[model samples]
Target: MACQDSDTARLIDVELDESVGRGTPDVEHERAVAIFDLVEENSFRPVGDSGEGPYKLKLSLVEARLVFAISRENGEAVVTHILSLTPFRRIVKDYFLICESYYDAIRSATPSQIEAIDMGRRGLHNEGSQTLMDRLKDKIDVDFDTARRLFTLVCVLHWRG
Candidate 1:
């Protein structure tokens, strides 16, 4: 039998173009989990004649846009889509601020305070993810969870880029 299984349109691996840089352990952990969760379970399919997937993706910030560079399992380039980061800017900023609050709350604030901040963080995250999905509507297909995870990765990229 062939070593590779049947080709399916999904993400198998992912990479970030730049290091997030110094003193952000929490951000680094978020990046790691985003990649792990995405590879473990995601629905990714590029539109048009991109060929079969089971893809390896590299996400990067180029200028003001976020780039999705997709390749096949064999390392053949499949498609590249650059999405404008404009729509996500405000929400991402809000998410970061809420996350900071949530983290600080965990260390010293009451459980209720932590929960409230967490809820706000989750709301902003979902909004950011949805905006991403809308922006990529014609270029790629991604489920809410995949978009959510990808949004986290994007936030990290934006944080450093």
Candidate 2:
């Protein structure tokens, strides 16, 4: 979907907490790409009269809770939402497992095998995205694709290695 100039309900900047250590180069690459894609096209609007147009977001994990710190394009403070990560733990674990399998399969497994693992990976990803959307329903309004990309960043923050 094309973003209109009048559509001030999109995100222009997204930042992850520095405390969340970056893992491998692959993980870093994934983080970078997710940020780029999210900034390029996203629909994020804080529910209520928080602020206006083209917001900035900071995602972090604090005391096992996921924090979403939002601000205006000019750095003005907006609403901050802290969500429990309990809903995501199992799905994130499953996603990581499927991702590991997909990575290994890409090395020597047949194309069909790789595809099968990838399918599972996408399924878990979708589940996580839906969960995220549901959790944020009361605090923020985001499209499905935007939720998917945001969910990717959420997974990145959960990376322990």
Candidate 3:
């Protein structure tokens, strides 16, 4: 999808709330990579003239709600969107289960079995990505890949292990 100037429409930095407990080493690695990828290349535009581009985002979960604290590159206040987590509950739960299965499969299952499990995991991830995009459509405009990375961050917030 077309976006503003590549430098301006992208995320310059991404942070997760400190209150969100850390997960297992593997999960932590995944979170780190997701943030890195998001900051490297993403198309994020806050709906309306909330602020100029090159935004910084802090993802947090508060009272069962997903909080998107966005700001300008210079630390100027932009917009904070609190979205209901209800729409993502099922997808997140299923994704976690599939991820567990895929990880376990990697250790002993056949290559084909592992591949199958991974496919399922990706399917669920895509579903979650779409759900996130749909939910944020009125708040922020994000492409599919951006939504995928954001979904990963959201899952990171939900991670308990």
Candidate 4:
């Protein structure tokens, strides 16, 4: 629902389901489908699974959430299903980069996303880490320092991989 139509999000398929929801057919969408395949849970890793053929994409709506899957079908992503369930939601580097590319993505996030982020960041910081920028002679926004730290942290994570 957070997605907009101005982007390359294309509807791929629709199918009926007896489980999960009522008579709502699963509506498959292929916006940044590659995103799903590229990001892994927690560890934030990318594993190449691109192989020959028709890419079958599926989405199922269960419990008021959207769930999707991808597979090859005929040298294309033939999304075969759609479900409503959010599971194995991973935060990979691509997701991070995607989020960074469009800061608006975060800015427009729903209340749930904000809460999720807040919950995830719990205990990741220490007390008194927050500080106001003091007037320094060099005169650079400390925000830049935060960015640098994030970049270095990503580099270190990749290096460890």
| Cα RMSD for candidates in order | 4.8, 2.4, 1.7, 18.1
lDDT of 2 at 130: 95
Task: Write down the worst ten-residue block by lDDT for model 1.
Answer: 1-10
Query: What does candidate 2's lDDT look like per residue over 14-102, in tens digits?
Result: 98887666688877888888899989988888887445778999887788798899999899888899999999999999999999899
Model 4: weakest 10-residue lDDT segment is 38-47
Give TM per candidate: 0.84, 0.89, 0.91, 0.22
Q: Write the per-residue lDDT of candidate 4 for residues 76-131, one digit (tens) a residue.
A: 44232232222212223434444343455467888777666554433122111121
Over 4 Å off, model 2: 1-6, 22-25
**Full-model lDDT, candidate 4:** 0.29
lDDT of 1 by residue, 17-120 (tens): 77334337766776788789879887888877447778899887777877888898899998898888888889988887888788788999988888888888
Who is ahead in TM-score, 1 or 4?
1
lDDT of each: 0.79, 0.86, 0.87, 0.29
RMSD in Å for model 4:
18.1
Clash pairs detected, candidate 2: none
